[model samples]
Target: MNLHQESSGEITLLKQKAFNLSSESIRDEIVSSAFRHTLAICQDVTKVKDQSKLLHTEKLDKILTSRLFGFPIMLAMLGIVIYLTIAGANVPSSMLASFFGWLEGYLSLGFQTINAPDWLHGVLVLGLYRGTSWVISVMLPPMAIFFPMFALLENYGYLPRVAFNMDRLFKKTGAHGKQSLTMAMGFGCNAAAIMSTRIIESPRERMLAILTNNFVPCNGRWPTLILLASIFMAAGFTGAAGTLVTAGVVVGMVVFGIIVTLAVSWVLSKTALKGVPTHYTLELPPYRKPQFMNTIIRATIDKSAFVLKRAIVIAAPAGVLTWILANIMVGDTSILMHIVQFLDPFAQQLGLDGFILMAFILGLPANEIVLPILLMGYLSTGAMIEVEDLDSLKKIFIDQGWTWITALNMMLFSLLHYPCGTTLINIYKETKSKKWTFLSFAIPTGLAIAVTFAIAQLARIFGWV
Candidate 1:
């Protein structure tokens, strides 16, 4: 036979051989071989002075990943991170707000000097500028503090331990072990989290991760959660105690979100995307000293700035549109008021007012602007505004008839609502299926509405509102 014929024959024989092998057996063989090789290498070259001796890192891991202590440690660590972010960001956030507030006056003066119309001033200085300022002031400090710390953990190789600690839970949920990692990524940005689902090899599990990742509140929702927790949940306490209580409440919300993630994953796996969980070995990397400066620089530029830029881009245009709605009157009321009135009955049933619901609806583009929009709508202002402190913010909510039920429900709703517009776009792009993308939105939104409605009804029945 000629060369071409010989090559074709060999290819046919290889295909037949591959076809004859069972997939399960092939996978078992591959895993066995990999383990065998690893054992052989370690046995041949590894050395220890004492067989029972453990390194400092290994000792720490033992406690960190212990069955009884692991979760509590994780929660404690999370609380510390959140507390630090909340406490540290307060001063900078205030300074930024004051600076922006001062700049707003100059902006208005300049607009007047140029003979700009009132509407023009409202849209530019009050709407876009104020919106952007709120995002930066409220979001930047926490992100600057949070992302670098998170990156440090990642650099030190602690994050994989987090995944490892949750592996059993995920497995029981019929989801991939790595879904925990993606969910962790969701804390930074759900869009990025959805993209990270590609790490999950099983199609069904990947889809499950994509659908449920939004259960973990992203950075955009943090401000709202912190604001509500500090003002309402921690109100009775004072000083450092109050601050600690606020952080604890925020951490509790995060834990609640994780619980929801696991529950939803379990439900989807058992129903819509039924499948066996795929098993993969996760090799824990040796812990090392983190490159502190490098981690900070990379996280700030790559994660923090990237996410903030997207929020600003979306928020600016939304702000302009919000201004128009608030200013454009139909009959005696503005268009914004009309829509709020239309949604009022439904919102009240959910322990929220029309303005709150409207803010959430308008905030679909970027969650960072939700509070600002709510403030503008409630105050009947044509532009977004910021208060000087928590007391001022609390007074506004109280004056608007906000009870504990409303604050609690707002936190719950914010936690469970549909992913932001950017996240939805990412889901569609990743899944390449409108059905799954729609389900992603529908599942969370339906859950949000159902949960808040149930809580509200129960509160009313018990006279807790």
Candidate 2:
């Protein structure tokens, strides 16, 4: 044969050879072989085994990553982190709220001095500004406190062990084990969590992670959940007992979210995203002392700012709209009531009032502004509501006909609702499919409505409400 013909034959043979090989098993065997060779070389040249740090890490790992003790320790650590975040943010949040309220008074006075139109003043100060201020005051403190400590755990390498611990559970749902990492990241921010799904090698598994990331309440929802739990659920209790009970409720919500995530993943895997789960090895690194200050600084700047900036940007417009809704007249009633009235019948079926439902709709941009919008909807005085204290806020909700069932449903809906605008955009960007983006939105929202509706009906039937 001529030279060109000979080259074509060689290329065709290589293609045939590659076609015969199982792609999954091929790289795995190669990696296994490489590790064996590297180990042999290390054994040939290296000495002084049983290094101190290595020994300590292994010993700790025995308990921390053990099948028996791992789950309990993980739960305990979660409770501790949650408790610290809740306790630490309370004072700073109140201080920020008071400071902002003081600043708002000056701005309002300036508007009055300028003789700005009443409409203009109300829109600027009450509608737009209060919305953003509540977001900052409420979201900033907990996020600032929660994320840095989360970063510390990350820097110290405990997060991967968390992934290791959750691996089997995820696999049973036909998801990649590394989805646990994305889920953990979701505790901070769902948009960031969706982005973190890049670590999952399989496209199917990554999609699973992206779709379910919102099940776990993000940082924005934490303040609302904690406040509701403390105010309504822990009504008859006080002191350490009340605090623990609230924390337990929060943790239970997380566990419930995980179960819902797994159930959804399993259903999706069986139907829409049909595939067998592919396994990958997870490398557990030796624990090292995290750089305390550096971790704090990065988490504060990177994480807090990431969520805060988006919340503020969305809060501005949402706040203005809420103000308009509350102020604009329809006959004798405000336009807010008109919309709320339309939604109330349907909302009641889900154990939520129209004001609560409207808040969630407006909060599509950012979950941080939900409570503020809801408060605005409930107000008849056209005065800005200050969520400065849990007691006052709880009183307002109670006045609005809120009960434990309402609180329970609120938490459930918040946990399972559609992604925020930013997160939806991120999901679209990651998936590059309008279809998947819509499904990601539709799936959670439908589930939320159905679940809440069922709970509401069951509660009524059993007279639990």
Best by lDDT: 1
lDDT of each: 0.88, 0.86
TM-scores of the candidates are 0.90, 0.90
Which regions of candidate 1 are displaced past 4 Å?
1-37, 46-54
Residues forming the 10-long window of minimal summed lDDT in candidate 2: 24-33
Candidate 2: lDDT of 274?
Answer: 89
In angstroms, the error of model 1 at 101 is: 1.7
Q: Candidate 2 lDDT, tens digit per residue, 94-135?
A: 999999899998998999898899999888888778888888
lDDT of 2: 0.86
Local error of candidate 2 at 197, Å? 1.3
Q: Estimate, for each residue in 333-451, the C-alpha lDDT of model 1 and write its tens digit.
A: 99999999999999999999999999999999889999999999888878898877778889999999999899999999999999999999999999999999899999999999999
Candidate 2 ranges with C-alpha deviation above 4 Å: 1-41, 48-50
- Residue 436 C-alpha lDDT in model 2: 93
**By TM-score, how accurate is candidate 1?**
0.90
> How far out, in Å, is residue 283 in model 2?
1.4
